[model samples]
Target chain A: MTAETAVPPTAAYAADAVLTEVVGLLVEVVGDEILIATEIDRDSSFNEDLAVESIEFVALAEKLEARYGARVDFMAFLSEMEMDEILTMTVGTLVDYIAAQPAGEPGGEV
Target chain B: MADVQANGLRFHVQHLRGGRASTDRPTVVLLHGLVLDNLSSLYYTLAPPIARAGFDVLLYDQRGHGMSDGAPTGYDVDTAVDDLAAVLKACGVTGPVHLLGNSYGGLIALHAAYLHPESVASLILVEGQCLDPAHSGLRPAAGGYPGGWVEDVANTLNLIAIGLECNPLGGDLGSRGARKAARMRAGADTLLNQTTLIEDISTVRLLTPGELAQVKCPTLALYGGASDLVDSGPMLAGQLPDCTLEIFPGAAHALLRDAPKELLASVLRWLETHSPAAPQFTGSAGGYRLPASGGEGAP
Candidate 1:
């Protein structure tokens, strides 16, 4: 894990900031061509709207781990969800999850 | 998201740390089925629980699959096994690891144990097609498919190849798009049309009973009751020295997708019983045993 500072503990907890970070990760997974094609927002559905494949979703989870660290247990959150719930999940749902986690240093080991 | 260079190809690999950071449990490496399957099947369903259960998990996309770099050739079983060994080496996993494979992936795992017994601790084969058509005499009845598992798979792939060649999915990525589906289709199209994947599968050297017997490690063979490949379970259980067979009721070939909860339970239980740290059970009859009762779908 790199020691360089990430989003400060306070800003990392902000809903809008988390959303921006998530969108950035999404770009990394799906590529910027998607951004030009579709407008990603809080209501954008990962599956239906973004057309994010399951494997790409896993990549997104990896990015979330790198950005937010172990404080946000994305896999655990998804594990608790039914397949249907997961498919129907939105960007807002994930942003809320990230923002709701207890503030901590990014990239910190659990 | 790590791009591992193995077998002269780039593979996309993911490692999930176990909950118990200093645990003695062996790492679990997951292999997905053929085309239309990837590490996500196990990653979303099994990896988290396995990691939480104190077993580190490793997932990777095989050659010409998922996010991995596609190759024009080298899709045979031996190549697949070599790719696995190379991937493990590149990932720095030196210890014997448990291999959980689904469908085609299962066949590769079984062969890995046979070829490199020292590297594999155990095997969890879900709907693994193990027997060679020639040895098993699995001839398709008059007017049936064609030959055996290999031919059947080849025929299926041939159809897919034709379809993909004709349609050419993802051609119009700009307008009217399901980008994910289109991208997957495009990947499949290239692998099927441009590569020797189908020919490689058709010519794959399946495991003989003699070869299977050589795999001495503890093996758990899982199958869906309604699966076409269920017949292979009995053959594996009978041939492998120490094998346990389990059948999921009313499920089809996709055990990981259809019966994930049951699959996870069985995996966890099998790992616990077979773990080196697990208490030794004296005088347990081991070679090829089914459950006491209700081996099929029974309430």
Candidate 2:
């Protein structure tokens, strides 16, 4: 399969710093199988273009929640999107959502 | 049943063979949930009925369960499935076998199917959760019938309580099955957790799309709407492919005992829906014998 071409980042969301860190977590949770380059961005669909599954997203949510002192509601993600949608979700979307949430002690909830 | 002497393993298995066994009907192997009244609980409740439906049913206890010898290596998911594999091999019970796992047994079956998809025909999960060591109902990770004898008993009780709450067969949340489950909880037996199983979750994610796609076989996820094992069973159903989900309106985790007639009907219906041919095995002196050598491919 050809690498999913990354949607260009047009330097629009300068405040989305948390996404850089979230991409690191994604790399760790997802490993480097589908990723071709480290120049990550929000337009990546974690499952679709990238091949991640719903379970790993739970791990990603837990990892982000812990690393950032935020409680990402992983269950909500389970209901809202398929793995394909997640595979291509933009980094801006992820960081914006995390920043919107209240921070807490980082950890997994079961 | 013919037996194969596995290297380093003391147990030898017997494969009950024949064209007489060749009813062309598929077999559903029964794995015990917990708190064994021995393998009889599985065989008596599940095996014959499944056979009557023209599906073959294999029932056995885990190490330390029923007549099976216990090992210091003892109860966990891998060993349980290994024992099952050894049993299937010894009996030449090859080809696709439907696995019906109750409680922890169901979890082991999941591991088995995941690791050795070739051996698994399909899965019939009766309240089995995709457990992570971090998430079973127990409060302590190191519990069950271990450490001192007291912890072991407590662990067993704790283990039963988890299955009771999550089992699809358990009857009305407050019914006799619940009472029996509560009583089982108070008595406790074995404490098998899934730390190793948890470590293996990453492997599950490693399942290639090809493997997942190959799993186009029928899957039935059953839950007695009365049980509390999970807040939701349909949610799990949605995650699986080619799955048929059902809620036994009044049944619970102990469906066989809680609602025997209903359980029988539902099981037979599911078996019929899944099985391609009539389940016929010539009655033998030892048990149901085969009509032919159990084949090496899908039924």
Candidate 3:
């Protein structure tokens, strides 16, 4: 799960870059075995497509915190969503959230 | 993905940092229930708002549950208490902290406070089954189960074990392309079928009234109004010296899942009134920090 591009931490990441990072984190979470059967993409639904269980989602949140730092606020993003919205959320939803963050800021609201 | 070596086994743990970097409030540790339950239950529910309300939160999968290493033995309440102490030690949590437990986890929390009173600041028990039916009047006639809480839970697990053995839902779900569900089912199958979980649960020594009276920490016990374990709520409130009880109307045993908003409201209010530190709520401004390198995050 190596970063394909070394974008400056101060610059806002492109949507594609966030997607790649998210997919890499997913690989770390659900395992690379998932990649052998299905191609992860922006449209991949966490529940139906990837079968991301609640515990695995927590793992993904931890990874996102490690990679993108506190500006990502994955738990805050989740706190605003209803149960159904969370279950039906897609990879693009998270990627877009990450991409929208003000790059390299000390702190920001989700 | 944090794993802590505690009680001679690897346990999955998640720590959510609060709003302030430094505060006098105690860190909140949440414990999930038995089979089919994990840290995620509280992780998605009470954990976030509690963190947002300026208290560092800790959630962990108990032994033989979730991503933690399983064992064929040691499922009794005392062992679970030891595991909690060991997990706290492994995580470097030395100060007295709050313990919130749901269902079986509630039983563990009660025992922990009773045994290690100095280490626990407070307790929150949600549908905790700590009293024996014979003594607490939680017989089969009241809860519609075969026996007391322990016996009823053991019977339910035995039924699930038999069903899993006969049908093997994990393999079936995997064949049907549901990998996550299959994995969860398989983990449950291993714990129920292969381990001494049922036997250990059946032999659990329910807390006596005298012991409950000895747990002097401030306690909040929440239960669903319609849950089978609702009876324990009043009993806990009556026994524990500093206990407050709340029963959500029309909710069942799964209070966290069924009434998360209400649960969050109660929990936030409880922490606010009881927390020693000044309340600081940054809302979305709250963010959790990953443990520093070579800290609890290390495998």
Assess each model's interface with DockQ, reporting 2 decimals per model: 0.49, 0.01, 0.43
Whole-model lDDT per candidate: 0.82, 0.53, 0.82
Winner of 1 and 2 under lDDT:
1
lDDT of 1 by residue, B144-191 (tens): 324567778999999999998888854556543455668778888888
Off by over 4 Å in 1: A1-13, A106-110, B136-146, B170-177, B278-299
TM-score of 2: 0.49
Predicted complex 1: DockQ: 0.49
| lDDT tens digits, residue span B1-299, model 3 | 39999989999999888866325677899999999999988888888878888888989999998778999998998999999989888988777788999999999999999988877888999899777757754343444444678888888999999988887754445431466667777888899999999999999998788888899999999999889878767766888999999999999999987888898899888888776654445556674443322123111
Q: Decide which is better by lDDT, 2 or 3.
A: 3
Task: Output the number of the lDDT-best candidate.
Answer: 3
Q: Report the C-alpha lDDT of model 3 over A42-106, residue by residue, as the tens digit.
A: 89888888888878888888889988885678889888887678878999888888888866755
Report, to 2 decimal places, the DockQ of model 2. Answer: 0.01
Candidate 3: where is the Cα deviation over 4 Å? A1-13, A105-110, B136-146, B169-177, B278-299
